[model samples]
Structure formats: structure tokens, C-alpha cells
Target: MRYLSLSLVVVVLVATIGLGWVFDFVYQQYSDPKQSPSEDKIEYAEILTKKMAVALSSSNNANAFITAWQANDGYSLQIDSINSLALPAPLLSDLRLGKSLNIESDSDLNIHYAIPNSSDVLILQIPYTIEDNKKFINRYWVTSLFYLLLIVLFLLWAKPLISRLINLRETAKAFGKGELSQRITVGKVSYISDLESEFNHMAQRIEDLVSDVKLLSTAVSHDLRTPLARIRMGLDTLSEEEEPAQRRVYEKRINAHIDDMVELVETLLAYARLDQSMLAIEKTSIDLFALTEKIIKNKQKERPAEHDKSILLEADASLAHCFAVGDNTYLKMLVNNLLLNAIQHSKTTVLVKICCRPNSLVLVVEDDGDGIPEDIKVDLFKPFVRSKANKNKGHGVGLAICKRIVQWHQGSITVEKSEQLKGAKFIVNLPSVEN
Candidate 1:
């Protein structure tokens, strides 16, 4: 953007100056007729000679007028006998016919003019100097050369801009024609670098959305089949039964299958909502230790009697107020999902720890069960991805939701093997905010 603005300034300045100069140049020729310095000087000499002739015509004032002018005017005036000097035939004939004669010398000492006065000549002398001495800077061909230089400079600047625009146009055309992976490449000093960056970012987002849609379509088709078949089986059985108690039992079984399908649809919708919620999340400072304590107690109360695993939160009392700036509802959901995932996978205990790092607050959830299998651990946060052992259980979007929540908060989450518990450990670092 800065480069674009600076180019605009240069273009405006050059155009304004060039246009003004051209207008003034054209106007000068039409508005005023110019004369050469030599013509003007000859005209002045003619007037002077005529005035002196009139003054010398009067015998009473002739000597006084000539004497006064010789002392004041910067000219050499003398009366010479015309018969004593040998003169050219053409000049002498013109002089005898009452014409004035201007004599130019090759050495450029003086301009001498003669006028015939009876048997003598009136001579007037002045310096032979040229006055129309102009510098060759803004004249004809130099001006053309200046404008040509401007054209060359502008082309040098515009070449890169035009090339970048062409690249952007072609990349956009390719993307429009279903090339979702296509992106524009530009240099750091590019005129439209920001525009290229925005295009790349938007392209990446659309590509991810399309990929998620395809994954959801495949998952819905594959996952809904078993519940739908069970529902069909229960409906067939209910239709065959005659007794009221037996009919109620089959009806309840069918209702259970319907409920499972409903849950599946809702969980998928929730996963979709997480993507959109990024734009509307309301942020506030949250104390992670306090929030996690409530989530652990609630999960403990909600766990079934047949499950004996314990949920424990371990954090230093001094660092209990680990404030992180993010949406309260989503942060709570992030903790709940991680804790729930651990509780479900562990055999004896699920441990959650909140600790402080140099620049962020860390939240860790670990389970004391068999560590995550290497095959599924890589893509564990992806939606609809489930391990071999839990393939028939949940919807498999819980950890995916957790990952999205952490991302929206500008935090990071990673899964590893727990050194302390020898089980799967989920580590999340949320950036801390000042009070």
C-alpha cells in the first residue's frame, strides 16, 4: 500500500509540472510575436540618425546639440569627408540616394553606420555584441528528451506492477475454475503484496471448508447406517408383537435407536458451529484453575457408579489465578472436553494440572490407561477420527472441538505420552494476559 501511494505522488507531480510547462509554451507562440535583437537595434539606429539630421538641419543649434550629445550618449559620432575615403560602389550609390548604411566588421569591434550630409558623411558607432544568447536546457530538442526520460522511468516502474496484476488475475481465474489449491505468489517489495496475502488467506479458508464438507458427507453416510438398521429391526419386531408389555418394550428399543441418531446429528452440528463461532466469540479474562476445579467436580458428580476412575486437578496455590483472555463459555467447554476424554479413556485415574510457563499458562490432562496408539495419535484432533478400541462408542469430535477452541484463543495444543502416568497426555498452553 505504501508503495502504491508513493507512486501516485510521483505521477501527479511529474504530470502537473509537464502539463503546465507545455501549456505555457503553446500559449507563448500565439499570444506574442517576437523580433530579433538585430532588427530592433537597426530600428533604434534609424531613429537616432533621423533625429540628428533634423537637429543638424538648423544651423543655429547644430554645433550645440552635437556637442551636448557627444558628452552624454554612449556612441562615437563624427563628420568625415566622403570624397577623401575610397568606398564600395554599391554602398556609395545607396548612400548618395539618401539611404543609411550599416557596416559590420569581422573582428566584432564596433557597428559603424554612415549617412550622407552634403559633401561629408555622419558616422555613428556602437559595440557589435549579440544579445540573444540563451542556454540549451529547456529549448526544443532538450524538452523532448526530458519527456522521453519521463516515459522511460514510468515504464521501468510500471513493468513490475503490470506483471503482478497479471499474475493476480490469472490466479483468481484458476481458483474460480475449481482450482481451490491455487494461490498467488509475490515478492516482499511487491506493489500489491497485501492484496496477494489476503487472496491466499481467503483461498486457504475456502479449501479447508470444502475439505471439511467432504469429510462430513462421508462420515454421515457411513455412521448413520447401523442406527438406521437397528431402528428398522425394532420397528419390525414392534409390528409383530401383540401383548401390550411386549409392544412397549420393542417401541422403547426403537426410540433408543432414534435417540442415537439424533445425538449423532447434533454432535455433527456442534462441530460445524465451532467453525463459525470463531467470528463471534466474546472474550474476557478467565482464571483457568478455578474454572477447571468446577469442571472436575461436576464430572465427578456426573460419572456413573460403575465407573471408578477419579478426576483430580493439581496446581500450585500461588499460581491458582492463571488468567487467560478468551471466551468464558468456549474456555469452559475446552476444559470439559479434555477432562471428559481423559476420564473415558483412563482405567484408574484422570489427572488435570494447571501450571505457568514463561509467556503462557499450561493446562494438561492425562489418563492412567494404555498410552495412545501411535497410528491414531497424529490425526487425533481431526473430526470423525476414532481409535480402534473406541471405534463403536462416541462421535469422535470432542478432541476436535478442543483443538478449535484452543486455536481461537491464539493458543496451542499437543498430545504426548505422559512420563509420570505412562498414559496419553494432552497439553494446552493459553496465552496469559496482564491484569
Candidate 2:
């Protein structure tokens, strides 16, 4: 494409130079003669005037003046010695007022002379008229047509190649964003064939690595969970009366450890399934406002009596009618995780707000509690990441799962300080179905 554009530029430069030369040549041909008035036709006119002056001085006869003018091809002249010429008003006035002595015809073909010796004046006209050079004009037009054809041909030739390159770039970008299944299609351009082949090999390798990692994670979780479950069962079989408090303590510790293991396994499984290619997404247009209301109501039912009144749900009615393109189950999971996290950490009030924007559906959950610690905020989305400040809370898989789910939906999740309340705010931005 660069070479083609350069070639086009060169062609345009050559055409411009050629056209300029042709126009210069035409201008030179039509320009006034370089010879002075005394050397060219003007000198001839002066000689004829002298002859007419001598003829009139010797014989006072107008016939000799006419004969002298005719011998010099003066018949084509508009201004002649026998009659006073009707000059343009300005020129005639200038001449009568003694400001100038020459007059030119309207076409600049003739030079009229005032002899000051005879009533008959002398007029000298050149027989030159500008004619259009068809050959030169045709050459210019042909060159222009050739330049236009070259541009059209370049576009026709490069369109597919350019599109293929762009598609390859987009596929690489998508793969970088975790779309491991994407592959570049073959194109006619042989220049990037090696690149395409390498890219395909890399994508295949990535897919294999991801598959192996997932299989390994699944295997590890299954193997570890079985032994962990056996440990729990063995602990449960311990007698309660054999140091009852100590046995109860031992059982609680074992149960807590088992719970942590189970949470870790669940988190791993969720992360592994975050790949959209692995997921069977059944996208449907869901009314998000009603869905959110339903989630809040369910949460209210599940929470303690005092907490039910503390949950504040505020949604724009107009925005409540909005829809989103997503797997309903995944959407529900996302909402539930965010709300549960907020409710668990909230001190007094938990606020849920749903609003619709031009490009996205916005769900914000804010809690009036100690916000996430500033130090651990950066690693909050990573699996099993728990801040020392909130370490006693449930295992830190909820936020990671939330991140994975939002990413799979091509949406975003961000944590910040709430504007309306002094607490942590979790904002979920899902792409609008209407958009």
C-alpha cells in the first residue's frame, strides 16, 4: 500500500509538471512578440509612415498614401491613413489630449499610427490569432484519466489485502483480551502468510495450555476435595463427651478449614468457566430493573429482620424498563454476589441503585461501612486476595467471581468511594441491549 501510494504521488507529480510545461508553451506562443516597436511591425509601420509622408509632401495625392499602405498588407487593419479611426473612448481622448500616440485594436491585432504629416493615418495589424492546440489538451486529459484509473485500480487491488490485515490485527487483540478461540483467516497476500501461520500456531498453543490448566485445576480440586471431605467425616465421628469443649473446638476448626477449601475450589471452577468459548451463553433481553428488585426482595427475605429495613433500593423508573443482553443466570449471579458482598460489610445502610445510560446499564451497590482498605485495593480482584482489615470476613472469592462474570459479559466492574454515602461503592456497567 505504501508503494502504491508513492507510485500515485510520482504519477501526479509527473502529470503536474507535464501540464505546467504545456501551459507554459501555450502561453509563450500567445505572448506578445519580444521585438521592440522599432524593430518589428512598429518599425515597418514607421517606414511606411515615412514613405506616406514623402509621397504626400511630393504630390499631395491620397492615392499614393493608399498605394503605400496596400503594399504593406494594411487592408486587414481597422485603422488606416485615409480615414480617422473610431478608437475606444479612453484611447481616443488620451490621443486627442496628446497623452499618447498609439492605438491598439480591441483584439490587440492592429496598431494604429498618427503620422502628424497627412490626414491619412497608417494602421499595422498582425495576422496572428490564438488557436487551441488539440494535441496538447488531449495529452493533458489522457494523463488525468490515467492518474484516476491508477487510483481506482490501486483501491481495487488493495481493498481485500487491507481488510485482511485489519481483521488479523483485531483477532490478535481479541486473543490478547482472552478470546483464545479466535483465529485469523487466510488471505491472498503472501507477504504476511508466515505471520498468519505463526499467529495460528500461537493461538493453538494458547488454547492447549488453557485447556491443560483447566483440566489440571479440575483434577486437583476433585482429588483434594475427596480427602478433605474424609477429614471432615473423621472429625465429625469424634465423641462429644471425650473433652466435650475441646472436641467441639476441634470440630469447628475442621469445618472452617473444609469451608475454606470448598470456597477455593468453587472460585477456581468459576474462573475456569469464565472463558466465553467454554460457556454456552443463552443471551436474552432481560428487564434489569425488575430483575434487581427481585434480587433485593429475595435478599430481604434471606437476611435478618433488622437488616431488612436497612436495605435501601433506589432505581429510576424510566431506567427500570431497560433491558440487557446477557445470560440471565450469570446476570443474577453477578447481582447476587455484589449485593451479598455489600450487605455483609455494611454497617447501617446498604444502597442499591440502577440507572440506564446511552451505552450501558449501571448497577451501583454502596455500603455505609469501612471502605476497602487503600493498600489492598489494587489486588482486590485476584482470587483469594483478602485484606488484613477484612480477613475475618468470608473467603475473598466473591469479588473475583464478580470480576470474572462482568468481564465475560464484556462489561466492567470498579470499586470506589461512594459519592452519596461514606462507604465503598461497587459499580457494574453492563452493555445496553438497545445499543
Candidate 3:
């Protein structure tokens, strides 16, 4: 912290000094006494020059005016032949035309005018030596000192800020070194308070995701063992059975085991893919209402074969074109998962509704079956979470995949009691494209 503060202070001091020099140079250029003196000083000089010219024009008072001009107000008077003055031709022309002149030197000023109807030139001199500007130079030194002191104070005040940033960096390093619990505790008083808070949030998410992955690994191992053991038993039984009917029974049991394993593996793979950092996805404009209707129609055709019962799958699209921004494949997965869940649980009817709002599209899938239990509804989207009410004994990863897909598309989903169908309702909201 000390090194950083010193470095920053030195850089600031150098910059401040350079800027001060530049500003002084510009001021001197623009306010040069020879080119553009202050209005009051110019006016006073002009008045004095005119008074001297009038005095020199009168022969009777010329000698007295010369003596008065030399002794009063540090002015010197000189009268000489025009040729001896050695002035510029342009200046001589101006003087001959009755124009007065004021010329500035390093530390003095000379005012000149030609005496009317004479060959002589009258000159008045005012003293302003180098010593006269000492006060201004000293004031400049004081200003530079003042800025240097201010810069030092600012650096000292930032000491706590540097310490806080160092603490944040060390905490992040600890986190990177496998200490997942490390977190920053700085509050609103610090400079990077918002950044620290966001870091805490990100750390918490990472911890939770790690815990979930561990849980998913354990669950998969436990769940897969049962099916594999069953399949092994079926193989042994089929090898022993001689009757055709019994052999067929074993074959069917083994096939069921294989099917269950395949389903579980697919679900686990889908969940794992979502956790990956680089899941390539392309978003485009989709007619959400049309997509929902098409999915419902396809599900209706397969409903009887899967459920062994006739279920009415109805789609009510509120708009002709409910356009949204999303990847087509993820949207299909989101809708298919929700619709399949509803279809499997519905008693007689499943309803799908699509609507368009100001900046988003809303999709709702509801089933007229028993609603979800309050206890499990909160964690319905968590991996390996299944309610006791779901008799089908699903792996409980489908809704988790749906939740991830929704999040990937920058959308949201929630489960609630269906007010219209008196059952479990799933609502999905997606960003809509402008018409």
C-alpha cells in the first residue's frame, strides 16, 4: 500500500507541475503586456500620452512640462529631431499623421507623439523593472506548493482504500486455491463495496453448484446400481428358463431395465451439459404461439398410446404472432418438458396458453390433476427432486433441465397452483422481439 501510494503521488505531482507550466505559458501568451495589456492600464497610458502631447504642442509651457513629466510618476521626457529617434518608418508615418504611440520594453514603457507644426518628437518614459514582478512569481511558487500539499493529503486519505483492495485480492486468491468458503465482508463504506458484494454472490453460487454436483454424482451411482442388478438377475433367469413364456418374461424385464438406465443417463447428460461453460446456442425470432400449438398437436397424437387414456390437450393462443427471442432447440425442450409433465399427471384435460405482453411472451401449461405438495414445490426444479405424489418415479432431472434452459435464454419460470384448471401450473416467460 505504501509503495502504491508513493508511486501514484509522484505521478500526480509530475502531471500537476506540467499542467501548471502549460497554463502559465498560455496565460503569458494571451495576456502579454506588449500585445494586449489590461484595459485600465492601456487607458491610463493613452491619457498620459495625450496630456504630454498637448503640453509639448504649446511652446510657452514646453520647458515646464518637460521638467514636470520627469519628476512626476516616474516619467521621463525627451525632445529630439525626428531623424535622431531612429523609429520604424511605419511608426514615423503614424506620428506624422498625428497618431500617438505606446511601446513596451522588458521593464519599461515609451510613449511618443510628434509635436504639431514642428520637426521635434516628444517622448514620455515609464519605469517597470524586473523587480516589479517578484510578487507574482512568489505567488506562483505558493500555488505550486499548495497543489503539492493537496496531492499528498489525498494520497494519505486513500490509504484505507488501498488496504481494502488488498484484502479483497487476498480473499479472491484464497478462493481460487480451493477455499470455497472465503468471502469479502466489506460493506457500503468502502469504495468497491458493490464489487465486493457481487463477488460474494458469485462465490455463494459456485459453492452451491459444487454441492449440487456432488449430490448428483451420489444420486446417479445409487440409482444406476439398482437397474444394473436387476438386469443381471434377468440375464441369469433367462439362461435357466426353458419354457418360451417364461423366457419372454425375462426378456421384457431386461429390456425395461435397459430402458430405465438409458432414460436416467440421458437426463444426467442433459443436466451436466447445462453446467458446462460453453454451450453453443443461437437465438432467433420464433413465433411462440405457433410453436406451442404445434407441440400440443403432436402431444395429442401420442397421448393415447403413452397414457392408455384419452386426454384433451387444448392450446389457446391469445395473439396471431407471439414472437420471442430464444434458441429454437431450447425452446422446444422447455415446452416439451413442461407439456409432458402436465400430460403425464393430468386426469382428463391439459391446457396450454400463450400470450404476448408489452416486452415478453408468457407460456402457461396446466393440468387438471392433483396440485403439487407445498413442501416440494419450492425445490421442484432442483436436480433429483421428485414429489411422492408423482407415482411414475421419474428421475426428477427434467424440470431442472428446463430451468437451466430458461436461465440460459435470460428468462424465468415458476410453478404455482392453477387457478383455471385447479391443478399444478407452470408459467414460463421469455423476452419478446419487437414487432
Best by lDDT: 3
* Candidate 2 CA-lDDT value: 0.68
- Model 2: worst 10 consecutive residues (lDDT sum): 127-136
Question: For residues 1-435, what per-residue lDDT tens digits would candidate 3 score against the true structure?
Answer: 344456567757765786667666766665445533344666787677777676667767687767766777676888877778778899889988978888889877787878887887887787774444664575587677767766776677577677888999999999999999999996645666767877987886687688679869887888899999999999999999999999998999999999999998887786777756326888899887667778877876865565443434344354555578988877988898898888778787787877788788888888888988887887888888887767875898778878877877778999999998899999998998765
Q: Which model scores highest in TM-score? A: 1
Candidate 1, which segments miss by more than 4 Å at Cα? 1-134, 138-171, 183-198, 304-307, 315-322, 357-359
Would you estimate the TM-scores of all the predictions?
0.63, 0.50, 0.60
Deviating ranges (above 4 Å) for candidate 3 = 1-138, 141-209, 236-244, 275-278, 305-322
Rank candidates by lDDT, best first.
3, 1, 2
lDDT of 1 by residue, 306-373 (tens): 25787778886647545888889999999998887887778898888888776688899998988788
Superposition error at 233 for model 3 (Å) = 3.0
- In angstroms, give how far residue 353 of model 2 lies from its true place: 1.0
Q: Which residue pairs in candidate 3 collide? A: none
- Residue 84 in candidate 3, Cα distance off native in Å: 31
Per-model C-alpha lDDT, please? 0.77, 0.68, 0.78
TM-score of 3: 0.60
